[model samples]
Target: MNLFARCYCRTYQKVFLLARRFLDFSEPDLLEREGALKEDLPATLKMTGLDHFFLVISKFLFDKGVHLEMEKALKERGIVLTIYSDVDAEPTFDLIEKGVSLYKESGSQGLIAIGGGSAMDTMKAIGARIANPKKSLPKLGGVLKVTHMPPLMVAIPTTAGTGSEVTVAAVVVDKANHDKFSINDPKLIPDIAVLDGSLLASLPKSLIAQTGMDALTHAIESYIGHSGTKKTKKDALTAMKLIHEHLPSFYKDAKNVEARDAMLKASYLAGLSFTKAYVGYVHALAHAMGGFYGTSHGWTNAVLLPYVLKAFGKSAYKKLAEISDHLALTGKEANPQTKAAAVIAWIEELNETFGIEKNFAGILKKEDIPALAKHAEKEGNPLYPVPKEMNAKELEKILEETMG
Candidate 1:
């Protein structure tokens, strides 16, 4: 039988190639707003991998009437549907505790998270607890502990940043500890991510700016960071290209469906890129800012992105030059590092246009920088591939310079 199978496999290689081309390539239309996403909810369900309908929670997208669609669909499938509408800006351990109990009571087989990054990430954690009921929240701390998550999970992002849908790491704040902890595990990757650009139509200009910039930072940093491979660089670069083409237009016209769709696509691409490549100094510094100031994630990234570019240009000179050519920016003659500085200058200009301030020097005292820097260092300093190791003093300089 084995010999026959091998002979048949060899005989069918060409046949299989021809057969594979018959596969369907048409995708379910991803809608832009709640009405569109709702009208097309059945199609989204068709793409989902989960067997049993379970609890569904929405954050910003709730008022869009997704709740009714989910309730109706789940009930039709004879599955339970429970909605936890309130997902905080930065979820704490307490949020996990509440979500776990909600899952326990609902007895749902899977979870559907429809919202921005915070809601999406919180739902991921909620799914984790339901999968591992006996373990307390603290046990799941740090990297690689949970063996398996729910059999299926689907993420729908209403916003264009964080890429939380595709990312494995979820940041959960420990309010009592006055810090944020990383939930690092590849298993947590959402089985499916639904990025609907039409949902971005009503987004306020402020959010549009913040999330779009966050996506840009993800693309640039992921491409430059050494954690990535050739494939990672491609994904990041593609993401960057999308941003260059569409971000300014999206900023100018928040309701432009074409630009909105492109921005959303860029965010998803950046998420996929960074999921493997990992982010660099910008994210590390942003993470610290998030912990210290409870600042908006996009705002932190927006403010710190230029500084990180400067730092990376100092080290990843050749890579930065490549990026400069890729991005088509003027640079110092014969200096690879100049390209990165150009990148920073571009970011600074964007910041000024958006009226986003970037000064941590006054906000964080000298005493705070050491702890933040130390925590950042411990979190994986080498991830950035930064030219020089920034000590407390050096980090302070970055912070001071950023205070405009």
Candidate 2:
């Protein structure tokens, strides 16, 4: 990046960080337990006087009947439920519009998203459309465009990643343009978040590994970013510690309730950290890959994280060293560079342990590098507050490395 542009980006990030204090970045009312969905969701809905609400879920979970118990409980409580299970691995503007139409026709007064990041993002985008009928999804794509409050929003994360349950942003794909973007605003934060550990029991081992690494990426990226605050750093460190200690165990044994709960909490804390501090090239690149190839977001993050950190080099040494110390991944006597390298090595080890590919060799086409790098540069630049400023050419080099 040019000196002028780099200075402008840093100045913008500093201003946003300063203004963050006055924003209502509140944590959701948390209902956490093994059976919160079946036992508590109904009662909570009744208490909130929501007679009818939209229940957004992924088709995979809906097909598996994972939501049956919750549906039965809601039925027993006389809380009318409208199910929208069209959400896929990536949510698009058209899909969100379909959901908005369904929500309006169903007479739903609130929204409850039950699945992974895609489902939660779908629900949030639907709410954004409903609240801002005058603005299209593209127009609402940047910062704080959803000026009005959406309907009462609740998020239930079935996966231990993405932390869409507590984030202030909703990622939506524009399939027509083959683009992915985030609609960011404080109003998009969920009013309630249900952390049910039992829901994770059925997740595949690969998913557990991917999502666990995704949470870890969130922590590291936010912690290393220049926009971090005291609270964000504290939360990020705590999240990293939890993921380091529990992710491998959870990956090996999905039935471990304690590990499941800890991972869920870690994901939430990572979300809290990154929502304020923001993520950098890893997320931007991952989003671009997701938009183009329909790749798994968590898996892409897991693959690109170490490479991006390595690219950051000296700029990220101090923060990565702090993370290494926090996770006890290196000896106390290690220098900052050594500690940072250890942190990157740890991420690579985690990926190898999970059987994730070291690069995107077959998945990412050579021809797509320029477009992908451009998309990543556009998404990241001013908003991300990365420790090192990288332009399109620089990001393309990292992409080339990932292309193997």
C-alpha displacement of 316 in model 1, angstroms?
2.1
TM-score of each: 0.84, 0.98
lDDT of candidate model 1 versus the reference: 0.69
Q: lDDT by residue for model 2 over 156-222, one digit each (tens)?
A: 9988988889999999989898888999998999999999999999789999998898999899899
Worst window of 10 by summed lDDT in candidate 1: 23-32
| Candidate topping TM-score | 2
Instruction: Tell how far residue 32 is off in model 1, in angstroms.
Output: 9.8
Identify the runs in model 2 with alpha carbons over 4 angstroms from their true place: none
lDDT, candidate 1, at 258: 83
Clashing pairs in 2: none
What residue runs in model 1 are displaced by over 4 Å at the alpha carbon?
Answer: 1-36, 39-60, 64-66, 73-80, 331-335, 382-388, 391-393
